[model samples]
Target chain A: MNRLFHLPLSPFSRKIRIVLGEKKVSGVDLVEERPWERRMDFLLLSPAGQVPVLQLNGTTLSDSTAIFEYLEETIPEPRLLPRDPAQRAEARRLAAWFDIKFQREVTENLLQERVNKKLMKSGYPDGARIRAGSANIKYHLDYMGWLLERRHWLAGEALTIADISAAAHLSCLDYINDVDWGRNAAVKDWYARIKSRPSFRPLLNDTVPGFTVPSHYANLDF
Target chain B: MNRLFHLPLSPFSRKIRIVLGEKKVSGVDLVEERPWERRMDFLLLSPAGQVPVLQLNGTTLSDSTAIFEYLEETIPEPRLLPRDPAQRAEARRLAAWFDIKFQREVTENLLQERVNKKLMKSGYPDGARIRAGSANIKYHLDYMGWLLERRHWLAGEALTIADISAAAHLSCLDYINDVDWGRNAAVKDWYARIKSRPSFRPLLNDTVPGFTVPSHYANLDF
Candidate 1:
C-alpha cells in the first residue's frame, strides 16, 4: 500500500491529506511521525526533515505543493486548479500566500510556538511570538473577509487549492483554539462550508497527545 | 510594454528575472521598486507588499513561482521545469528548499539582517541571527555539494528551476560576499557554470547605493 509520513497538526501535512481526500485518491496509509525524532529513514525521504511525505506507485514525493501539483497532473479529476492559466496562477498565488506568508506570520508563531515546541521538547513558547501571531491573524482574517466579499471562493467561482491551503493553516490554528472566528462573518461561513466537507472530517478528529481538541473544532457549524 | 516591479536583491525577484531572461521573452520593462515604500499602487498589485510582480497581457501576476509557471505555460521554449511529472516534482521540491528553507535559515539571517536593515533603517543587524545564519549556510552548501556530485544540475540532468532558485538566493548572498566558495568544490563549479550564462549577467551587474559590489561578483572566471 502507498504510505504517507505526516504529523497530526502540521499544516503542510494537513493540506496534503485534504487534497488526497478531496481528490478521493485511495490506497494510501497514514504514518504519523514527529519530524524532530530525526528518524534516519524519514530524513532520507525528505532532507528538510519535514512532514507530509508521500509514497505513491513506488515513488517517494516530498514537499506539499510539489505533491499537490503531481497529484493534480496524474489524477485531474475534481480539478483543484482552474483550466485557464491566469486562474491557475491566481490559485497558486493564494496557495503560496497561505503556505509561505500566513505560515510565517501566523502558523509558525502560534502553532509552532504553542504546539510543536512542546512536542519537540523545545524551549517554552515565547509570549511575544504568541502575541504577534494573535495580532497578525486579525489582519489575515480581514483580508480573507475582503476577498470573500468579492468572490464565491478565495480564488474564484469554484473552490480551489487556495481554499484548501488557507483552511489547512487555519485548521491547525483552530485546533489550538487560536483563531477568533467571531472576527469575520464571511470567513466563518466559509470555514463552516469547508468544515462540512468529508475531507475535513478526518482532520477534525486528529488529536495530539498533550493538546486537547477544542470543542468547536469538530463541529460542522463552527 | 509589459513590466515587472522588483527589488534588485530579492531572490524571488531574481528568480523571475532569470526565468524571463533565459526564455528570452521580450517586451517586459523592469521597474525597480522598494517594497518597504508601501506604495498604494504597488500594494494594489500585490496586497502582501512584495516585489517581483509582473504585468503582462493585461493580467497582473504576483508570487515568483506563479509568474514563472505562467511564463512556462505561455512561452514553452527553454523549459525551466522537466516534462516528466516526477522530475517536475523533484525540481519544485528543491526550488522550495532554496526559496523557503534556505531563505529562512540563511538569507533572512544574513542578507535581510545586513542589507535590508540598513536600507529600511531598522535597528542594527542582530548579532545572534547573523551568527546563526553563518553557521547554517555551511550545511546548505554541503547538501548542495552532495547533490551536484551526483546530478548534472541541482534537480537532474536538465538545468531546471531548481538551479535557478538555488542560484537566485546564493547570488543575493554573493552580493554581500557572504558565500564561501572554498567550502564546496562541486557547488562552486555548478555556480560558475550558471554564472557564465546570459541570464545571470544582469544580476551580477546589480548595484545597491550603500553597498559596494564585491570584485568576484561579476567575474566569470572566479
Candidate 2:
C-alpha cells in the first residue's frame, strides 16, 4: 500500500493530495504528520522533515515539487503539463509563482500565523503580519485576475499544475477566511471552476481541529 | 540572438549560468539585472521580477527551477537529472534542499545582509542576521557532509542539478568568505570536483564592483 505523510493545512502537502486526486490514484493511505514534532522515525524517512512524503514503488519520496514531477513521469495520464516544451515551462513557471512567491507573501503570513501557530500551540498571531498578509493578498488577487482575463486556467486552456499550485495555497488561506472573493471577479470565477473539481472535494471535507471552515469553502458555486 | 538576464552572485541565476556552460550553450548575451530595483521593463519580462530570465527559443522564462527543467527538456545532452524516476526525484529533492531550505536558513540571512545591503544602498548589515546566518550555515554544511559521506555526487553517482544547485549557493557564500572549507572534508572534496568544471570557471572570475574576491576564490586547489 502506498503511504503518504501529510498535514491538513500545508499548501505543499495539499498540492500532492490534489495531484493524486487529479491522477485518480486510489488506495493512498494519508498519514497526517506534524513535521514540527521532529520525530526520529519520520526524520529518517524524510531528511528535510517536510510533508507530502510518498512511499510508493518501494521508494520514499519527499519535497512536493519532486513528488509532483515523479508522479508526472510515472503516471502520464491526463498530463498536468502541456505537451509543448514552451507551454510546459510556462505551467511550471506559474507553479513556482504560487509555491515560492505567493507562499512567501500571503500563505506564510496569513496561514502560518492564523493556523499553524494555533495548531502548534505557539504564541498569538502578530497584528503587523496579519495586516501585511491582508494587504499582500489583494495585489496577488489582482495579479491572478489579470492572468485569468486572458487564459481559461492559470496557464492556459486546460487545468495544469499551475492552477493546482495556486488553488492549494488559496484553499489554505480560504480556510482561515483570508481570501476576499469580491476582490477580483475573474480570480473568484477561476477558483469556483477549480473548486468544483472532484479532486478538490477531499480538501473541502477536511476539518482541522479548532478551526472552522467558511461556509462557502465547500460550495461548488463559491 | 538568445539573451539571459542574470546577476553575479544570485545563486538562482548562477545555477542557470553553470547549466548553460555545462551544456556548452554559447552565443547567449548576459544582461545583469537587479530585481529589487523593480524596473518596469524587467518586471514585464518576469512578473516576479527575478533572475535569471532567459529569452531563448523566442520566449521569456523565469524561476530558476522552471528554467532549468525547460533547458533539461529542450537540451537533453548530458542529462542533469538521472534517468530513473527515483533517482530523478532524489536529484530534485536535493536541488530544493538548497534552493528553498538552505536559501532561507543561510543565504537570505548572510548574503542578503552582506551583499544585497551594500548593493541596494540599504541600511548597514544587521549583526543579528549575520550571526544567525553564520551559525545556521554550519548545520547545513554538516548536513551536506553527511550526505556526501555516502554518495559520490549530491544525488548519486552523477553530476546532476543537485550538485549545480548546491554549488551555486555555496559559490556565492564563498565570495563573501562565509563558507568554512575545513569543517567538512567530504563536502570540500565534492565541491572541488564541481568547482573545477569549465562551467564553474566563469563564476570564479566574476567580480562585483564593491567586493574583492577572496584569495582562494578562483583557485581549484583551495
Candidate 3:
C-alpha cells in the first residue's frame, strides 16, 4: 500500500493530497507525523524534515512540487498542467507564487506562528509577524481576485495545479480563521468553487487536537 | 531576440543564466535590473518583482524553476533532468533543497542581509542573522559533503539542474567570501568540477559594483 506522511495543517502535504484525489489515485494511507519530533526513521525518508513524503514503487519521494510533477508525468490523465509549454510554465509560475511567495509571506507567519508554535511548544506567536501576515494576506487575496477577474482560473481557463496550490495554502489559513473572505469577492467565489470539489473534502474534515475548526470550515456553501 | 532581466548576485537569476549556457540557448540579451528598485515597468512583468525574468517566443516567464522547466521541455537536448520519473523526482527534490530550504536558512540570512541590504541601501546587516547564516551554512555544506561521498554529483552521476541550483547559491556566498571552503573537502572537490564548466564562466565573471569578488572565485583550482 502506498503511504503518505503528512501533517493536518501543512499546505504542502494538503496540496499533494488534493492532487492524488484529483487524479483519482487510490490506496494512499495517510500517516500523520509531527515533523518537529525529528524521528530518526522519518529523517531517513526526508532529509529536509518536511512532510508530504510519499512512499511508492519501493522509493520515497519528498518535496510537494516534485511529487506532483512525478504524478503528472506518470499518470498523464486529468492533467494538472496545460499541453502548451507556455501555458504549463504559466501554471507552474502561479503554483510557485503560492507555494513559495505566499507561503513565505502569509502561511509561515500565520500558520507556523499560530499553530506550529503551539504544537511544538515553541512560544507565543510573534505579534509583529501576525500583524505582517494579516496585512500581507489582503494583498495576496487582491492579486488572486485580479487574476480570477481576468481568467477562469489562476493560470488560465483550466483548473490546474496552480489552483490546487493556491487553494491549499488559502484553506490552511482559513482553518486558522486568518483569511478575510469578505475582502475579495472574486477570490471568495474562486475558493468556494474549489472548496466544493471532492478533493477538498478531506482537508475540510481535518481537525487538529488543540485548535477548533471554524463554524463554516466544512460548509460547501462557505 | 530573447532577453533576460537579472541581477548580478541573485542566485535565482544566476541559476537560469547557467541553465541557458548549459543548454547553449543563444541570442539572449542580458539586462541587469535591481529588483528592489520595484520599477513599475518591471513589476508589471513579474508581480513578485523578482529577477531572472525571461522573454522568449513572445512570452514573459518568471520564477527560476518555472523558467528552467520550460527551457528543459522546449529544448530537450543536454537534458537537465533524468529521463525516469523517479530519477527526475530525486533531481527536483535536491534542487528544492537548495532553492527553497537553503535559500531560507542560509542565503536569505547571509546574502539578503549582507549584499542586498547594501545594494538596495536598505539598512545594516543584522549581526544575529549573519551569525545564524554562518552557523547554518556549515550544516548545509556538511550535508552536501555527505551526499557527494555517496554520489558522483549532487543528485547523481550526470550533473542536473540540482547541481546548477546548488552551485548558484554557493557561488553567490563564495562571491561575498562568506563560504568556508576548507571546511569540507568532498564539497570543495564537487564545487571545483562544477566551477570548471563552461556554463559557470558567465557567473564567475559577474561583478557587482561595490563588492569585490574573492580572488579564488573565478579560479577553478580554488
Q: Ten-residue segment with the worst summed lDDT in candidate 3 chain B?
A: B201-210
In candidate 2, which residue ranges exceed 4 Å CA deviation? Answer: none
Note the DockQ of each predicted structure.
Answer: 0.85, 0.93, 0.89
lDDT of 2 by residue, B1-222 (tens): 699999999999999999999988998899999999999999999998899999996888899999999999999997999999999999999999999999999999999999999999999999999999999999999999998999999899999999999999999999999999999999999999998899999889889999988998989999
Q: How accurate is candidate 3 locally (lDDT)?
A: 0.94
Worst 10 residues of 2 chain A by lDDT: A213-222
The digit string of per-residue lDDT tens for model 1 on B67-177 reads 988998888998999999999999999999999999999999999999999999989999999999999999999999999999999999999999999999999999999
Looking at model 3 chain A, which ten-residue stretch has the lowest summed lDDT? A213-222
lDDT by residue (tens digit), candidate 3, A1-222:
699999999999999999999999889999998999999999999999999999976879999999999999998899999999999999999999999999999999999899999999999999999999999999999999999999989999999999999999989998999988899888888998999999889889899998988998888787
* Model 1 stretches astray by more than 4 angstroms: none
Please, what is the TM-score per model?
0.98, 0.99, 0.98
Off by over 4 Å in 3: none
Residue A100 in candidate 1, Cα distance off native in Å: 0.7
- Return the TM-score for candidate 3, rounded to 2 decimals: 0.98
Ranking by DockQ: 2, 3, 1
